[model samples]
Target: MPHTTVLPFKALLLDMDGTLVNSDAVVERCWREWALEHGLDPAEALKVVHGRQGYATMAVLLPERPMELNHADNKVMLAKETADTEGVVPIGGAPAFMAAVADLPHALVTSADEKLAQARMGAAALPMPATRVTAELVGASKPDPEGFLKGAAELGFDPADCIVFEDSGAGIEAGKAAGMRVLGVGPRAAEHAPTAVVADLTQVRVVTDADGSTSLHVTV
Candidate 1:
């Protein structure tokens, strides 16, 4: 076992897509298609799409379009995504890492709705947490902190007492805004403003104490 430094925390908040499941290709493809359909710029669309809910992304990219249209496009994209879920992969060390903390107090906070999150998790064969704050449950998405705050609230832990695992700029922003320490995962995660950035979950270890406090010990 690796030497671990246990920090004091009450709960864990996790980001679903990139942090847990590698759905980058799926997300990029969907956004590109939506952008083409709306005659919008793909590059610009990508900026708004990453780490945001489908409806929210569409709304930003196609602001001139009606909310109904955005919602409809989101439905179509989600349906296609949910059915064609073959490429989804679990992030490195995600399975074992999740297993290590399965019994602890944790909740998922994601820009995806419950249905889409469940679909992706199922495709990736990743375990889902009992408590989750999905897009449908929150008024705003990441970079706004609503989802993470809601997740912390649902987990019954103070924001400062929670640690968040995230893989995107928006998710990291939300975690920090919620007053939680954040661990960044994946390639571009370092630029997301997390307290620490690691290549994958394999580099991270969580230590729990008898008093139900937790600390994340990350290698690298």
Candidate 2:
């Protein structure tokens, strides 16, 4: 099949979880286990956990508990997640798509801490970018525009000139708030107000410009 031609953008901002890696099962499992252990509702827990940092999600779910306890449990859950990375898959075409843009200006913006992000990406065998804005790297998480803006800054590009590939509502909100165009990944992305939405990275194509620019053209 022919690759769709992406329009040129100054830089690319990528979301780590559902966008680049299929770690949803692992995430759901860990959170469900954590919710059960904490006497929280699993469905409610999943709703709160989907796009936020683990510690932050815990705080929301268990507000009465001490922050330290939440942190400890978060660590335990993260450890379990790290050890249980068995069925991780790269989102379709992610490996080659990443390779196609490897040399370009790009950065990963994720709610996961650097450790978890690295561990998950390592398990998926996805190439890590030099610039990444992780949970620990930002004082605030997505929907706040902090991480996305920071990523654009780290890539030395203005937010208006960057394009973001994201899968979650929070990520899309962040990108939009940061003044960047967003391409939503995965089926549920319609809920997020994205400039475009596709099933996976496989539906996206990298288009190069004569001026040495690149853009992600999506098929869905």
Candidate 3:
């Protein structure tokens, strides 16, 4: 039997895409189209696309492009993504995990704006967390730590008292930068050096103490 790893925390911060919801199909469709339209390599663009807001991903792929232009393109891309939820679905064990934490101190911190976040989560049939830090709420994107920090603050927990669940390089880095322990959620998160990793939410069990503190029992 695999040993279980217990990680304690007062709050939880979750990333949407590639973590709670598997929106890879829609993500690939939108981004690949955008990349090809701009004469960039689709393969290369996708590497930096998983964990960032559209503008941030564009800035990385086209460093010479003006920030305003990236922002404009991001707006269009967000609309396209929001409108296409044809392939969105919950990650393995995500529905049960979300339900387990529904009344706990948890928040969704994603690169997606409010509408996109809602669309994807709704498409995946996952219940949305009441506290969330979306794109519009942050001045900077993941890998900058702004979103995670804001999520911790909104949940009334100190960074060290929070545990972040993520599946992207940028999201892992952002969680670490915010001083929270991170639980990487899938194949994509393996190389990111998260504090711990689980193949899926199936390998995880959430426990609430008599005092109401929460801890995750993860099978690594």
Which structure among the candidates has the greatest lDDT?
A: 3
Residue-level lDDT of model 3, residues 52-105, one tens digit each, is 999999999999999999999999999999999998999999999999998889
lDDT of 2 by residue, 1-220 (tens): 6445455687899998899999988988888888897788899888867667777788888888898887788788777877788778899999998898899899989988788889889988999999999887888767789999999989899988899888887778888999989988897577887888888887888888787766667775
**TM-scores for every candidate against the unseen true structure:** 0.91, 0.91, 0.98
Task: Kindly provide the TM-score of model 2 when superposed on the true structure, using C-alpha atoms.
Answer: 0.91
- Higher-lDDT candidate among 1 and 2? 2
lDDT of 2 at 92: 91
lDDT string, candidate 1, 84-146, tens digits: 676889999999988988998999888887888899999889999999988779887678888
What's the candidate order when arranged by decreasing lDDT? 3, 2, 1
Find the 10 residues in a row with the least total lDDT in model 3.
Answer: 211-220
At residue 100, candidate 2 shows an lDDT of 88
In model 3, state the lDDT of residue 149: 92
> CA shift at 68, candidate 3, in angstroms?
0.6
lDDT of 2: 0.84
Query: Candidate 3 overall Cα lDDT vs. reference?
Result: 0.94
Q: Which stretches of candidate 1 lie over 4 Å from their true place?
A: 1-7, 210-212
- Tell me which residue pairs clash in candidate 3: none
Local error of candidate 3 at residue 44 (angstroms): 1.0
Candidate 2 residue-wise lDDT at 149: 91
